[model samples]
Target: MANRGRLFWKILLGFWLIFLLTTQLLWAVFTLYNPRHEAPEDNIARRIGNVQIGTAGAVLARGGLQALEELKASWPPDERKFFSDSPVVDAPPQGEGALPSMQQTRGAVSRLVMAPDGQRYLLRYDLDGLRNEYHQGRRSSILHMPPPLFWLGLTGGLLFSLLLAWNLTRPMLQLRRAFERVSRGDLSVRLFPVMRRRHDEITDVAKDFDSMAERLQVLVSDREALLHDVSHELRSPLARLQLAIGLAHQNPKNVYASLDRIEHEAGRLDRMIGELLALSRAEHQGALGEDYFDLLGLVEAVVNDARYEAQVPGVDIQLTAHQPEDYTVKGNAEMMRRGVENIVRNALRFSAHGQSVFVSLSRVDSLLEITVADQGPGVEESKLSSIFDPFVRVNGPLNGKGYGLGLAITRKVVLAHGGQVEAFNGPGGGLAIRLRLPHWE
Candidate 1:
């Protein structure tokens, strides 16, 4: 149909025409390979000679030698255009003297047969009639193709080409429809069900489309949830600021207390705003200045700062290295430091007093693996997987710490650097977070 795309028709008609031409070409080749029919003149001549022989033999069988002689004379000499003008040479029969004498002569375009009854008889035929008869027979042979096979081949080819074209374009059509739906904000549209298990480049493309759609759905959903949480978070600070301003207006003489509260709320708002910006940057911003930096030294610096901070609870921060070599990595040193510091500080916040928060760095192949484990109460196993999500937290002493952006930022920064982060409950009754980064060789 005309509604089919150009590619569809191109494939359909192209294959259909090609197959038809190929069938005709093969037939011609085979026809040529076999011997051709006898020439028209030879066929006509042989047929005429046989008819004359049969007529003469029948005359002899029914009416004896006299009948054949009269019949031979009856065919007029003028009708024998294939006859030669040469006179016949008299000769005796070669064998069987009891039989009548026989004579035969070969001419350039005609043949003469003397009757066996000792008579010089010649059977003749019109050359034009012979030619017309031969042409008629030849036409019959030429038109004698089997109808069933002819129709079957043509019909089968049409069906085969149609099926092939349909198979080739069906996936593309499905993909086009899926893309149309997705562009209209239907992120749930998927191409996998339409693919139907065919394993080809087209199927591969469908799989990739499905993956893209699924990722888009997750991204849209997450962005919506993050927006809701942000609105809720901003309302609290704005309300506190408004209330502080109203209190200051109520008691002008005692405005210092309200001023301090306003300043505290303002500072809170500033930190939250700064953290929000960092989270956004982690998700969408490029690398924080590419440089090769020593990861072990960064860990030690973060540990020293955390140790000073941890002194209030007497929590210990321990660092261990499995290898003595420098763990050089390529990324923004500041981003990696912040990510590692967040994990360690979060661990320290929940760690029981006098308990150690262990930090270990090791190399496996081309990867630098950093694991931070604390002796604090770990999160629920079900919530462990989603702890890195924005604004997600479990019931713990550190639940309200830092608006829950620390781990999320850590995940984003690590992912941007082509690394991975995972969290799980440690065997020794605390939480453990691991970071795997590609080491610069």
Candidate 2:
């Protein structure tokens, strides 16, 4: 959580700095491309001074010093200061030493003028004072931005960055917390409901998380149920073995019968343990060996082996192949054989005397399907789905011979091979079990 906070701040600052720097760079480029021209106040002062000096020079030249003085005296005090004139009593120097065209004195423009009677005077206009007045009234430049607008933009960028960062990190933070809860064995945690409105990649991730959690919950529940069933199954056999031992101790004359009963119970326990181990191995897909084998050959072998068992009940077992070609499948041969044998033997167990069990192998689309069906009492419609569960059995004369792990092992082995197994009541009134595996081309 602390790390997420750091990430949020990093994103906010990164975006804000990028925006600010880009804005400043553009401003610099604009300033460089359009350089400022001469100030308006300076231009105005220069033009006004030229006009004033020209007017004063004309008055002195036509009206002499007395007339010029009278003109100055008639003007307002403020206006008189700008049009002062001084007499030039000295004669003009030789051609090369004549007065310069005009002289620019400090803060003033001075011009030499001669009257028609040969009288000369110097006319002057104060330009520096005029420039100062204009400068005081001028406004600031348009090229540069003001402080208030700059601060407003900065604040806006910060807020936008913060909002973007929060939107991104908030979902990530929720995912992290949900993962933490799952790690602590809280499989009920879900994310899609809270995040579905986003409609983005994060929402997809939330949906995936919810699926994973649900799968884990189911697996854990199944494991606990299996454990409970195993313990219950073991308790019944152990109780029977103990009763046989007590009877043998009380009656020494029937010790041989007690010993035979003990041996039978022991064998049953061994068979049950072996089936449990097979179920566990099937459940772990990684432990199986990979190989390619013929589905028709495997089904034929299972049907032949069940024939010997079927003879006891006078049940007939038949095998049929829909296609001439032997369908090939890829997986552990031994596990596949065991899975097929379990389904065939289960069918034989349910079958009555004079009944027949049908085993068929065929190709359906891209899959190899093996179906084992019995001509006996079928399972209840509602309980058909759970027939493959461990320790689940339908009441029958031979039900005691099984620990109810055969169908469960078959289901696990088929699943491990990326196949499917299902049970349904046959149309003619018996149970049918179908196994489908991917066909190896």
Candidate 2's C-alpha runs over 4 A off are 1-4, 30-149, 249-255, 324-326, 396-399
lDDT per prediction?
0.76, 0.83
TM-score of 1: 0.74
For candidate 1, give the lDDT: 0.76
Best TM-score among the predictions, by candidate number: 2
Tell me which residue pairs clash in candidate 1: none
Question: With candidate 1 superimposed using the best TM-score fit, by how many Å does residue 226's alpha carbon deviate from the native?
Answer: 1.3
Which portions of model 1 miss their true places by more than 4 Å? 35-154, 197-200, 285-292, 311-313, 396-401
**Tens digit of per-residue lDDT, candidate 1, span 1-441:** 667788899888888887766765666566567685545575656666556655655465456567755775787764343432222467544343232322333222333344445443333434445565445544444224334445555777788789999999878788888989999999988777767588778888888998999999998998999999988988887898889889888889658988888898888788888888888887764645678999999999999999999999899999999767769998788888988999999988887878999999999899999999998889899999988987776764253546777899899889977899999988878999999999888
lDDT of 1 at 313: 89
Position 3, candidate 2: lDDT = 62
Please provide, for model 2 over 192-311, each residue's C-alpha lDDT reduced to its tens digit, 9 standing for 90 to 100.
999999999999999999999999999999999999999999988889899899999999976898899889999999999999999999999888777889888878877888898788
Error of 1 at 401 (Å): 4.6
